[model samples]
Structure formats: structure tokens, C-alpha cells
Target: MFYRIITLKTTKEIWQTKRSESNRILGIVNNVRLFGTNFSNSRIFQKLLVIITERFETTISSLENINDLSTIILAELLNAL
Candidate 1:
């Protein structure tokens, strides 16, 4: 069996692409949650809120509202890991 080796450049490119896609999707979801009256109270939204608080070690009220949560998550992934 042959194995493929990935280069640093390829890894970086893949990371950048995934990050961009994640940010795009997060923005779309955030817009829907911000505008859709009933979505804010949705179970998924509440779960997301809990996750954010846990990840940042801060309460939801203490966290500053950001339009792009993916940036925060990506930064944490890069730095915290």
C-alpha cells in the first residue's frame, strides 16, 4: 500500500479554505438567528449559546456579541490547540 504525504503549504491552504467556509456558514446562521424572532429561542441556538460560554469560560451576557463567531472559534482552534 502507498501512502500520500501532505506538505505544509497544502495543509495551510486546506486550513484556510475550511476556515473561510466555516465563517461563511456561521455568518448565514447568525443572520437568520438575529432576524428570525423565534430562532433566538430555538433549542439549537440555546445549545450554541451554552457551547460558546463553555468554550470562552464566560457567561453569555459577558461575551461581546460578534457578527462572526467562526473567527473566534478558528482563533481558539489555532491558538488553544
Candidate 2:
């Protein structure tokens, strides 16, 4: 019947609309997850840099000249190698 056809078309339209909306929400969720991952990585890198700088400053605080600092750094690098 005509009424049955109209009802079937409306139901199909509604299902399609819901599918599109779900896809859009999924895209937003993926973007948020990527942003969270990048933010956490940035925070970790920043913390590591801070720790390294603090330790280096403390180690070199007693040095009076560039030559002495360079010598210490070279020795440390050589030891690492």
C-alpha cells in the first residue's frame, strides 16, 4: 500500500541520518584521542628536558671557566663512549 511505502521510506531515511551522525561523532572521538596522545607525549618530553637541564646546571655550577666546562663535558662524553 502507499502508506506502507511511505513508512518504509521514512524509516530508511532515519536510519541513514543516524548512521551519518554516528560517523561524525566517531571522527570527533578519534581526533580527541589523538590530541590526548600528543599532549601526553609533549608533557613527558617537557618534563625530561627540565630534569636534564636541572641536573646539568647542578653539575656545572662549580666550574669557573668555559675551558673547565668543556673539559668536563668532553670527559663525560668520552666515558659514555
Q: Estimate the TM-score of every prediction.
A: 0.37, 0.32
lDDT scores of the candidates, listed in order: 0.45, 0.40
Q: lDDT by residue for model 2 over 1-81, one digit each (tens)?
A: 223235555777756654554454445445646766643433432332243334235323433222233234322321221
Best by lDDT: 1
What is the Cα-based TM-score of model 2?
Answer: 0.32
- Among the numbered candidates, top TM-score falls to 1
The pairs that clash in candidate 1 are: none
The list of candidate 2 runs beyond 4 A from truth reads: 1-9, 38-81
Lowest-sum lDDT 10-residue window in model 1: 1-10
RMSD of each: 10.0, 25.4
